[model samples]
Structures are given as C-alpha cells and as structure tokens.
Target: MLTLTENASTIVKTLAAQAPGSDDTGLRISSTNEEHTAFSVGVADAPEPMDLVVESEGARVFLEPGAAVALDDKVLDATLDDRGSVSFAIGLAE
Candidate 1:
C-alpha cells in the first residue's frame, strides 16, 4: 500500500530505464535489519518471487516482504539534484 509522489515516480522510471533491465525493471527496497528501520536501495531487473510490487504512474517498486509490511501506509518521495543524482525518502501517508 505504499504510495509514490509524482516526483518519485518519474525518478524511479528514469533510474530503471538507465539500468540494464527488462520492462519490469524497478526500484527494489529491502530491509537490512531485524527492526526493518534501515533499508538498501537499488535498481533491479525484476521483483523477487516473494516481493510486493507497487506501481504508480508507470513506475514500479519492488519491496521485500518485511519492507512491504513496514511501508504499507507510507508514501515515497524523491528529489533529483542538478548533478543528476536521485534521493528517495519515505514518510507516513496522509
């Protein structure tokens, strides 16, 4: 149930396209700790078999099972810098 802002969606699409991946390319978020507070971000060719796929505005996000539950009510936002770098942030959904 994670929602993505327009900016986030655009950035995700761009990143996925730039990576060597198939049409299902997307941002993959996975928890690194037991508490699920910290996460690793990367572009993946496709979701894992157990991943929760979230899509918006043609943008795709694959979340690990734990990450999906932790972010179930969260919103994703992103900002692109002048240097062509992207940063993603998460927050509680309104």
Candidate 2:
C-alpha cells in the first residue's frame, strides 16, 4: 500500500478541506495519458468503482487501479521550495 509522510498528509488534508464539498472530496491520482507514462493528481468528489482508497492523518487519496499498483509500497512526500511552492515526491518505502 502507498503511505504518506506527515508533511504530505498535512498538505493533502489542507487542500481537501478548502475544496468545495470537502466532505466528499479526496485527492485522486491517475495516468496522464493512455500509455501511463506520466501521471496527474487532483481533488475529486469521490473514488471510482475500482479505485484504491488510502488514508493517513485525516487525509484521503483515491488511486486508479494502475496507479495503485505502481505506487505499492511507495511513500508520498512533500517539500517546500525556495519560492514557497510545495511539491510532492514519490519514492520506494525505506
């Protein structure tokens, strides 16, 4: 299963809370194209029928089947850059 670092969880929770219909919104991850060579992440109202739900620190993330498989045993991390912009990094679990 995919796991979120503390910072990642906090960021996700904050984003979700600010979204409209926050109660039903979660972070959704999926392929950017049919080839699955890239990915896209955004807030969604709900999970798809076969999506995998991963929760941590009050945040929820819905991963498409293929994304879930690709992220298995991976860790989701967040970092702030010099410009104060936040970004995410995905890596194998230690």
Candidate 3:
C-alpha cells in the first residue's frame, strides 16, 4: 500500500481545507498511461470504483488501482525548498 509521511499528510490536509466543498474531497493519485509511470494528483470529491482509500493524519487519499500497484511500499513526502516552493517526493519506505 502507498503511505504518506507526516509532512505529506499535513500539506494535503491544508490544501483540502482551503478548497471549496472539500469536506468530501481527497487527494487522488492516478496514472495517465497503462505502464503507470506517469502519475498525477488532484483533489477529488469521491473515489472512483475500485480505488483504494488511504487515511493519514486526518487526510484522505484515493489511489487508482494502477497507481496503487506502482506505488506499493513507497512513501510520499512533502518538502519546502529555500525558494518557498513546496514539492513532493516518493521513495521506498524507511
């Protein structure tokens, strides 16, 4: 299963709270290709059929089946750069 770091959960929760109608919204992760190498993240009001729901730090995440398979055992982390930009990092779980 895909996991979110403390920072990632915090960032996602903050973003969701700022969006309109976010009470039911979750960060959705999906792949654009069959290979599942290319992925995108966005706020979704609900999970698609067969999607996996992951919850951490009060934040919800919906993972498409393909993305779930590709990201299994991986950790998603959020970081703020010196330039005041936020970015996400994915890697093997520690």
Q: Which candidate has the top score in lDDT?
A: 1
Error of 3 at 3 (Å): 0.9
Query: Which candidate comes out best when scored by TM-score?
Result: 1
Clash totals, every prediction: 0, 0, 0
lDDT of each: 0.95, 0.87, 0.87
Across 1-94, the per-residue lDDT of candidate 1 in tens digits comes to: 9999999999999999999969999999999999999999999999999999999999999999999999999999999889988888999999
Q: How accurate is candidate 2 locally (lDDT)?
A: 0.87
Off by over 4 Å in 3: 81-85
RMSD of 1: 0.6
Per-residue lDDT of candidate 2, residues 1-94 (tens digit): 9999999998888888878884868889897766664778998988999999999989999999888888888898988779977788898899
TM-score of each: 0.97, 0.87, 0.88
For model 1 the TM-score comes to: 0.97
What order do you get sorting by TM-score, best first?
1, 3, 2
What's the distance in Å from true for residue 20, model 1? Answer: 1.3
Q: Which stretches of candidate 1 lie over 4 Å from their true place?
A: none
Better of 1 and 2 by TM-score: 1
lDDT of model 3 at residue 78?
84
